[model samples]
Target: MTQPSDYREHLMAAALFIAGRRWPVFPLRPGGKRPALHGEASCPRTGPCADGHRKWEERATTDPDRVRRAWSAGAFNIGLATGPAGLLVIDLDVPKDNTDAPDGAANFRALCERHGQPVPTTRTVRTAGGGTHLYFTAPASCRLHNTAGKLAPLVDTRAWGGYVVAAGSVIGGLPYETVGPALVHPLPGWLQFLLIPPHPVVRARAAAALRNAPAYARAALCNEEENVRNAPVGCRNATLLRAARALGRLVASGDLSRSAVETALRRAGQTAGLRDYECRSTITSALNWSIAHNSGRGAA
Candidate 1:
């Protein structure tokens, strides 16, 4: 039986999202371009930043007051843009999604689960060439960049294939009409009032929040490949080895222990810090390749 589109049902669905712990922002206008956030300022045309990235950064900085205002306007459907590589777009009208008719809905859900992101509901767009849009909520304290950065690594979607719809957009995907306003997911209320200045307490809080991020996020951050590639060689070798070993063991036995894997990563980091250095991304690709190809090694 066809069910009626109840506004209340959506409101209720949004309410259930609160259980996911994401902070609410502005009303999300589903299936349309979202407006720029209130306090955002424009980035300078020049000076050490990518044009696109600079623009958004400027907006975020310039419109401090407006941004604060928007933060205060509390509601669901609002979302912050984030990515380890930077902000991205989700162009749903791409030829691939149309031609392949891929099981994006399932893939999206699985990716979310694998990354430890709370499961979000998946729906098919009712447009001419149907596409899919997945939705879920995370802790309000979770920064958009961390969330996106973490999710980006886990997803297998093609770049132009599945872009992230930016804020101020009504069309989530061509076929998938985003029901905004009450359905919006915003930043957490507590986060809005945070000072975010150079303070011990704030720093401590930030560290704690980062530590509490979903397992997938922590794993990605500590992944041997990413850490080694980004860090100095002598420092990252052991971690790289540990990461490779973990993936090898997981693929070979299909039995990966989360605690064990983290312990190895901690060892690698400690080994490096003793020499005084941290932060690595150089070996990320190699480690990823090793982990992915391990299972295929004798399959042919």
Candidate 2:
């Protein structure tokens, strides 16, 4: 049986090992995955925490001295900051319950088969719960973000704003084990295509009715659709709201049928990269408010 001290020593060494490979690692709770850092509210307003409560990702360090100092404090697990490390890890997970559906690995395999390509080997880790983590080097030009089941059923990707439990980290008495070579290859082109955000299809089938509306309504439709599609990442919801409210007047005045406007706007919202639920709720609420405020049965 390993002694507690010995386990901790090994974990410290493991932290140094990954740091040597340029992965910025932060401390997690010993034998668990949660970051062991102090929260923002508990800040003493001194040291590095003095400036602000830096998240584990912000504080994740590649410096050997810091790694040694942090690990010397406790038998903490390792949380590799994926974004800072320039990693894109595709996490293949097992089903939560007993089900006949294919597990993540099999589904990923099927995805590869459909593309007529083999799984690209990289730095892989077998997670504690029998899942697989395939590590790849993110492209220099593209900044990928984490996604849940975006690639395939049960297959997720962690990039910016996420971290993965590093090898030698223990969870539920099972250590995350490295199963593949150390070399991290460039992301496979096919996989990259799947991970990249789809370009907005400015004129999808649902937006076909945009052409069928009256000249004024068509002009409104085109202007609002362009606004939604061109809206920057942070301003998407607000732009959608404004677009919905602007078009809602035409809908209320009976110049445009409610169904046609709603349908076109929904399509426009989606192509703007808003999620389905966000599109529905924002459009519905804004349109309702505009209709309630505007009084007309036909165009003025």
Candidate 3:
């Protein structure tokens, strides 16, 4: 007959595995996401807490002995403190309460396509709740904070002040498991741009150029902007690509300035709820490709 699950042993091994990676690990309440660390009010102010109450972030440790001792206390789930671990984790969550909200992974994929980029391949965990967590190394000297709905709908991030449930955690009879490479990749520059504040120098200059452009180029830009703004959810990226390609030909033919065309498409993409990085990447790429392949130079 098959042996029953050994809760403590299993959890201890899990905690050890993560700790071995040098990531500081803490505990979550078994079967839930809440931190299992002692609260300030309940602090006995003894042992490690002799001076004062130590929150989870302070108590998180990469030591195997501490992990084993902590796991011996109960069937605790692993919580990787991202900041201490030097990680930035992207949480692609499922729709809440069975609502009809868009799926996080799909939205993220669309966001990638809109920017002419492929999804970054990195360390990944499939959560028990049927979502995914992608892990990336945080940039040195940058203290990032958690962001909600910043990248896309259902796409959240955890860094300095947050933690992620690690593989080997369980909830509702499902285990969080590794589904990708063992190595965590450095965060991509494009993604970093999306997370940070944008500089307005290019956009300001692009607008000025558009004001002085010939009427035909201006009219063409107006038509393309409308197309992007009115594009439905599934068609937005394709529409933006097409418009960029068409305008790129104009730039090649000396009918419009590159920056002017780019500025118009960028605003139109953002109006359709695309992220800033996505708009810039897509427009720039399409323009480059179209300009290079322009056969009907000055035909218009």
Candidate 4:
């Protein structure tokens, strides 16, 4: 049996290995997802340490020295930050009742079939809970969202603003084991589209508006729309905000309904692969700014 000290050393080495790949990592409590730290009683602040280790998302770091120090303090599991690390992990959870139906994997396969592409083999981690974690590099313009059972029963995603317990981490004496190739693959474009579909209302209105526009105006609109669709990930939010502002102007000119313009810009933003929360916030903020400066014509 591996001694407790040996296990601690293994975790430290593993954490450094992941960090070497540019993935930000943090320490988790031994055998758990929680940050490896003393309880709130150890916190000196009267309220709480909002930026402490317990805040794994904020505390996750790629600094090798910090990782070394954290692991040296005690036995700790590894935690991988999803967003900042530019990763999207598909988590296939095993059913607790020991049923043989692998619904999650089945649905994932079905989704791949619909896209007419084979599932890419990537780094896969077998969870101590009998689940599997498939790692992929996030798409250029896309921000995948964390969802539970949305793709299929027992399937989950850890994306931006989330974290995953790293492979080689132990919980309750069971270590997460690597089950496949160690390389993370690029997410396929078709799958990216499905995962980040446009909002229905916005899609409908945008289509209708485009269909009714004059030919010359339609050409300009098409060009503008294409710019949003082709934006890169880092600029997607800003592109969407600009689109929203332009739409706000159209609304002020009585060329489009205020709600429709907002929805359409939001839909285009989402389809171009922006994070939903950030996309919506950008749309709202941009529209408000436009209205405030444009004589309150598109106020809503």
Candidate 5:
């Protein structure tokens, strides 16, 4: 095994190599997940701009020079910014202390089977802690959020607003290794559906009663509308689609008119900063899917 001191040069070389590939990279403290910085203050106390021990996500950079400087001082782990680099990582965590935990890989396979999709073989990285990171390209229209134990026990996702330590990074004298192809593949569509599922359409009561439905139903609709209206860039289409689908359920139950749903979705998408054409296309597609799947039924 290479001593920690001996790995500095190799780490710097790897950092430069990753940056050369246009993947934003940052430094993590030696053998730790925290950002590696000289004197940067942590966030909340000093805000994210102080540069003192700042979050790796905020400091991740694609500039080769910046990456070189980050690894020049000493040994550091490389962090990959997922969303900015258009990457998504599925982290299969194996419990270090528990011996009876279910195998994450097996669980992942079963999940794919349940979804009727093949497991994606992408860029796989073996983590220091005996876990795995499966890297894939982010879908063009969907921004997956990080969630622990969402897909299966100990299965996590790292995408928008998240980061993953690069394969060459070392922790506790153990290095992350590439166990699969070097290239990151695009996310499979069926897996994408499982990850970012459309909102469920609940059964509606009488159309006249729906107009005077309980406060909860109205609140749910308002929340969906707000989600569309406040969606950030890179996520507007998905948010708009969700909102439109919610409205479509209402339309299916005859609680809302199709034209009303379309107009509302268009307005909300526009408010969320989508272009006219994008809003129109997304709303049209979402309404079509919702109406087709939800026709003649209030429950989904």
Candidate 6:
């Protein structure tokens, strides 16, 4: 039998399935039943841990029939993983029409308004037949853990609350739809760029490199990759788009070598007075702390 400690790791890791990369942090569900699974039938109203250790029946294939049923009924998201105490969900909510974007637009708008941040230009995306997805170009900081307590409230699906961030990966939910591009706040663009990388070196390099690329593509590259494909896009700036672009330009223009770009990025990070290095270091410490203090529960 797996010890409670082992189960704890499994639970957190599983919860992260939805919240880990670009998903919201799985907030605590109400009634002490853990977070509710999105899209799937709500957990039987009894409570959490009614069973010694809540466990989900392993499925060879999550029912595609369920997904079809969900889409027809206007489900915005689907459940990715579920167990006795908790579940992970992703957006599958489809758009109402070609122009009607996914629920992500509404969600992001709501989140930004709540936070007093300016709303960005948005578009609807259709993922699979599941539903439309709204894309937002906020900041890379948006993807990290909900540090400001802004995300938890939005995602909080207290048992009685009757609201849920739809769960499930694109694969589980029949398929995700592409509504359009997510909204991007009309900032100086530099703000959006700088907030991207938690890495100092990458941030500096990307900052310098982006100077020469097409402005629209540069911004789109930063926001589009994560919002659209959910791919990291770049290593430091959420992926390597800026760094790679800079290197490519350097190679083409013969202005600098790849090694020089790297060195400049590092130097820029240190002298640019950006906090990517500091923030990255802090997050690394927090991760280590989280690992060290395993509480045998879902989240610390």
Per-candidate Cα lDDT values, in order, are: 0.36, 0.84, 0.86, 0.75, 0.75, 0.35
Q: What TM-score does prediction 1 earn?
A: 0.28
* lDDT of model number 2: 0.84
lDDT by residue (tens digit), candidate 2, 1-300:
345668788899999999999999999999888899998888776777777778888899999999999999999999999999999999999999978789999988877875679978998999999999999999888899999876677889989999999998877778898985977899998777667773445334435555566898888887888889888999999999998999999887766666666676767777878764457667888899999888664445
Model 4 lDDT tens row, 20-67: 889999888876888775555676543226564245676688889988
Candidate 1 residues 1-300, lDDT tens each? 112333324423433333233222223333333533332145444432445443333332212334344434432233333222122222233244345543444444554454445543232222223443333232344333222222222232212112233222223332224443334243223222221112366445545654655666446545653564455756465656555555544533334333333333434554654211111221234345556667555564
Winner of 4 and 6 under lDDT: 4
- Which candidate model has the greater TM-score, 1 or 3? 3
Order of the predicted models by lDDT, top scorer first: 3, 2, 5, 4, 1, 6
The model with the greater lDDT, 1 or 3, is 3
lDDT, candidate 5, residue 7? 81
TM-score of each: 0.28, 0.68, 0.68, 0.62, 0.64, 0.20
List runs of model 1 lying over 4 Å from the truth: 1-54, 60-103, 111-118, 121-138, 146-176, 179-182, 185-300
Least accurate 10 contiguous residues by lDDT in model 1: 274-283
Model 3 agreement with the true structure over 1-300: per-residue lDDT tens digits: 111267667778889999999999998998788899879999999977999988888889999989988999988888999989999999999997898778889888988886678989999999988999999999885677798877888899999889999998888778889985778999998788778654488778887888887898889999999999989998998999999998988888777888888878988998998866668777878999999999575565
